[model samples]
Target: MTIQKTISLRPYPRGFHLITSIIEMQLAEIRQIKAGILHVFIQHTSAGLTINENADPTVRKDFETFINDLIPEGYAKFIHNYEGDDDMPAHIKSSFFGNSLQIPITDGKLNLGTWQGIYLCEFRNQGGPRNIILTAMGA
Candidate 1:
């Protein structure tokens, strides 16, 4: 059987990045299903998903900085100006990363690393709500 869950996040900033309820969602799904694969998906183009360190806040901050450095804002080469300066940059970031992640499940629990955590990567600079989808397959 496969179970699905969705979570909504309200970001405070346009380009604000944050780790969301992926852990909780996975736990909840594990409680219902036993021994399976967990699939997490972000239903947005300007955002993405990744598994990273959850023990320290600095890890996330450093990742954000690295991504920003990799894709700086206010680039003159961007042709998509439909939203704003951060519009095309958001797309680039999404492309570089991803919109979904898959994790293994074991004995009704998510098989995550000691410091591993799932995060929602918001690239757009528009404070709003984002939706994340989590699906689990198993008995």
Candidate 2:
């Protein structure tokens, strides 16, 4: 079986937000596949998708802090300043974090680690709504 769909998320501030539940909620078709792989791709350039620690909010907070420090906004060297200081930095951050994820599906559920979860890394102060494309394939 195979299923695909695009999930839209509400706007969020610049931060790492846990969105595993949100994705699962939208892609209920995954449950029908006893074994498969779910491919998630973010359709925007300024944001990212990743899986990481989900038990503590501070992990997400620290992710934002460390990444910002690594690629601070308003860097004098940035040339793509058309959108604003955050624009170029957002692009850089997105590149580092990436825009997609592939997770194993077993027994009708995501086979993520016990402490793992999906995150939507919002790079802009107001990235507005984001779109995620989900593709599932299995027996």
Best by lDDT: 2
RMSD of 1: 2.2
For candidate 2, which ten residues in a row score worst on lDDT?
23-32
**Which residues of candidate 1, in runs, are more than 4 Å off?**
12-27
Candidate 2 lDDT over 1-139, as tens digits, reads 9899998999989899999999889988888988999999999999999999999999998999999999999899999988888999999999999999999999889999999999999999879999999999997
Judge candidate 1 at residue 121 and give its lDDT.
79
lDDT of 1 at 108: 76
- The residue pairs found clashing in candidate 2 are none
For model 1, residues 30-117, the per-residue Cα lDDT tens digits are 7766678888887888887788887787887787789898898888788896898888888889888898888888877878888887
> Can you list the residue pairs that collide in candidate 1?
14-124, 14-125, 14-126, 15-125
What's model 1's TM-score? Answer: 0.87
